[model samples]
Target chain A: MTAAATAEPTRRDFLYIATAAVGSVGAAAALSPLVSQMNPDASTIAAGAPVDVDLGSIQPGQIIQVFWRSKPIFIFNRTPKDIKLAQDADWQSLRDPQPDSARVKQGHEQWLVVIGICTHLGCIPLPHQGGFDGWFCPCHGSQYDSSGRIRQGPAPLNLQLPPYEFLSASRIRIGENSQA
Target chain B: MSGYSTYKPQSPFMQWLERRLPIASLIHSSFIAYPTPRNLNYWWTFGGILTFMLGVQIVTGVVLAMHYTPQVDFAFDSVESIMRDVNYGWLLRYIHANGASFFFLAVYIHIARGMYYGSYKEPREVLWILGVILYLLMVVTGFMGYVLPWGQMSFWAATVITNLFSALPGIGDPIVTWLWGGYAVGNPTLNRFYSLHYLLPFIIAGVVVLHIWALHVVGQNNPTGVEPKTEKDTVAFTPYATVKDAFFIGLFCILFAYFIFYIPNYLQHSDNYIPANPGQTPTHIVPEWYYLPFYAILRAIPNKLAGVIALGLAIISLAFLPWLDTSRVRSANYRPAYRVFLLVFFAAVIGLGYLGSQEPTGGYVIAARILTLYYFGFLYVILPLLGLFETTKPLPNSISESVLREGSPAGASAPASGA
Candidate 1:
């Protein structure tokens, strides 16, 4: 219904425009603090710095949890059969298709390194539980296979892999890697 | 607003102020002398009530903030101190907390009034969209405010809601991380939220200025949904509209004070009194009552990303309402089919809200799903089809005619206090 068809520009229209322009300029001037507040504060950025883990003590078939970037990182020392199961699984049918070799470094197949939080809703998944048993998130019943792919669950992707690399035979640094 | 301004300032100070700023004249023209439809109802009073509530929230919030600490460790104790140690702090805290709920209650009624009258129809589309933007801003502000207590419910609500962003495709986790300023809802997140929560209300105020400016620009939509055709159909805003608004606001304060004094914690979760422990999640997690209908819509869908999108759309869909309902007729008063559907739609929303509060299971999930479907269907299906097929009743010739026909309380009788 062209109900209030006052589209024709008038002196009041110009007044509104001029005032709004001034207001917008003032808003832009005030926006720096609004934006800068969201940036990682010094303490938070410091907390996010690279964390080093000594995997020497992490025996095969053992899973150790380490904190890096304020997230739990799981360093799993997979057994030979676990690695085989992870690798030999049909990667083609994965909800989030990433092969087992891709999740770990070239010679680090037995050392499965991934973030401990579930891909579904960030609840920490229980290690070696649920069907196909890599990690099971009890929050919403999301299942992750040994390779960490979302095999048969509501999690859209596999558990996230932090930027990490093998610094030595039994050591790794998270939050910084050559590729990333 | 009364076809021409005869506003000539006789007072020396007003003349001096008018020449320098002209804001005095603008206010007078927009508020006092503005011609409101003679038949405007108590529903119209909500705009003034909302403005008053915003002022209440800001005043109480600023005072509360003087004592409140943003640190997660101190946040809970700081709120307790506000309740226990600070003088008049308990009253201030209670009023501010319940003020938010009352604000929502007012805004929801205001929106319902607009919908029933089709205030969003042509010429007011921009105004309606601005209102939606204001609603979005309020939702964000409310959510951030909810997290400031750092209580169990507050902390977990922050966790669940911020993680809702992570359902986005590739940038989801990154956005969530950025939002949190870390991997989880922590001190950094709390700090940012506190800052933004304080900031958004001012922005809402700014939008409210524009909302009123647009209302004054286009003029008010009355119950008859008919535009003012002549000077006889409208009256100056000063005595009639202002008094009615004041009367309603006074009545509303009784209810507001009731909640503030008698049952401040009724709207709050018992779980929120307990401090937040990331390790221990409460058995049943739900947002505040105002957010439940939306929370229900989100959970009704099984897929994570889709659920998030559905929830997003539940709010965003409102912006499209002006265009979606293609009826030339402006009000449901004349449209019989629309009137029934609107009733059902409101009930479904209430049902969805109730279902959202319960544990999502065999019965609740089924109910939520059905209600969620109806919620979407009301806007997406019912409104559009009703526009095409509904047989509308004949409109009264003008607003004055409708008011005269009914012997309305707000009628042609001259206001006692004239402008």
Candidate 2:
């Protein structure tokens, strides 16, 4: 074959090989972090591990702050009265009715969970149960209900909930939830 | 005899090439035939300067993007890798990062130049309006691009700005949801922002084309505000304007290079050095300096919706400038009153920027609100009313007269005779 005719096939082969290499590299690069995040190991977890928290100390109508993987997670134990107050109040008109869903383990009721970061400007939401009976982000006046739902103010969404799972009756692991 | 002697035989290829290319005609039209007003001063060169800066930004940005990671998990680490690992990545990263600030600097100067010379007047109104739109797009693109790094400031800035949409009426919740692409500002939001951030620069480039096209249609306004009368009153754009623009551009590049080399991180927020932690909020969440003035306006008003409206008006007000100034004279040179007002306007903007950088204290907030009110009043009230009442000094018939008057000693020489 002449150089031109032979060159065409060689060029096609080179392009095909180059594209496949790049495609594989891209896929690997993309999946690596996600896979690691998915299956966090003992060493990785130990360095900046999810802490198991005993919610027995958390009183009804009160929230407990727990550190997990260097992030603050809010674990609120709401009583039936607190739930009734949230549902009956006019402040329930706020957006984000149920933002703490991801933080709550399956079949767990009256146990609310959320990332302490404010839904507005990421200020840690201060826990209070006054007339409104919810959390308030003092930085921008973002109000949240007993269920960690945004009630009012500048926050666009309810507070985030990091993945977590229940280890026992009183214990909860606050990162890399196995169920998720 | 004439045909045989005068017409020499030529190759068909050469003839065909000459006809198709017409290099001489192309050069003639682009450089020589296309007229620019002779009186164009340093101010007129800013448009060209802005064009050059835009080109630099795109070039540097493309190179930096090659190494940048858009994922929240790796974005900060990737930026560090670029600085430490990649060859000359520090240079690329610094240039792209600081290039954003320099771009805004040049654009501000360009806009100010337009204002001073009344480049926004009459036939140039559409051009000016297009410039305003381009400016708005630049702001949005910058905001989105800043968030891709997923640093402290980037994360907080995204959170602060995204939350503003929640202040909207009934559909605010849906709007915010659509904006975030999820319940919270998380991985999905970051991914979409990365995609859009990569896309907006090209859109800015497209708008800039329209900007220049509109500019070329009206031709550039000169310092004297007097239109060119004849070929003598104008110079060819090639050696004259092109060389002058090149000189200024070189000087500007030197300053830019100085920043890239000497003080690369001077414009950057220090907190951005830290990786984003959603749980811990930075004590002070401030935007980039270019956005300070408008951010001040946003915080000035007590009401959320009103503050947003005022900030929007601050930009939209520029669009009405053509109609606002009713003065027959276009340039600020002849309008003493307007010059003072322009100075005041500049000072007010600086004041607002300063206030925006500080924590919104009671005193600062009150001052900002007052200044914000005055800022709008300057454009909406003073500009229009002054144009009606303020008497401007008589303008020279041509640019040459204006230049000669300023150059010579006061009342020292007679005016030049008509050519």
The lDDT values for all models are 0.85, 0.76
lDDT of 1 at B95: 94
Clashes of each: 0, 0
Off by over 4 Å in 1: A1-37, A41-46, A49-66, A73-116, A124-154, A158-180, B1-4, B408-419
Candidate 1 lDDT over residue span B103-219, tens digit each: 999999998888888899989998899889988998999999999999988887888888889898899877887798776788889998999899999999999988987888888
CAPRI band for model 1: acceptable
Q: Evaluated with lDDT, which candidate comes out highest?
A: 1
What are the runs in model 2 whose C-alpha is more than 4 Å off?
A: A1-54, A57-180, B1-28, B31-33, B408-419
Clash pairs, candidate 1, are none
Top DockQ model: 1
Give candidate 2's error at residue B198 in angstroms. Answer: 2.1
Model 2 lDDT per residue over B1-419, tens place: 01111222277765676587755454455455566776676666777788887787789778888998888899999999999999999998888888889889988888887787788998999999999999998888889888888898888788778877767789866776667654456666777787877788888889887886676667778777887666556666767788888888888889999999999999999989999877656766789999999999987776667777787889999999999888878888778899888878888999999999887766888899889988998898898899889989898877656756667422211233110
After TM-score superposition, the amount by which residue B266's alpha carbon in candidate 2 deviates from its true location, in angstroms, is 1.0
Clashing pairs in 2: none
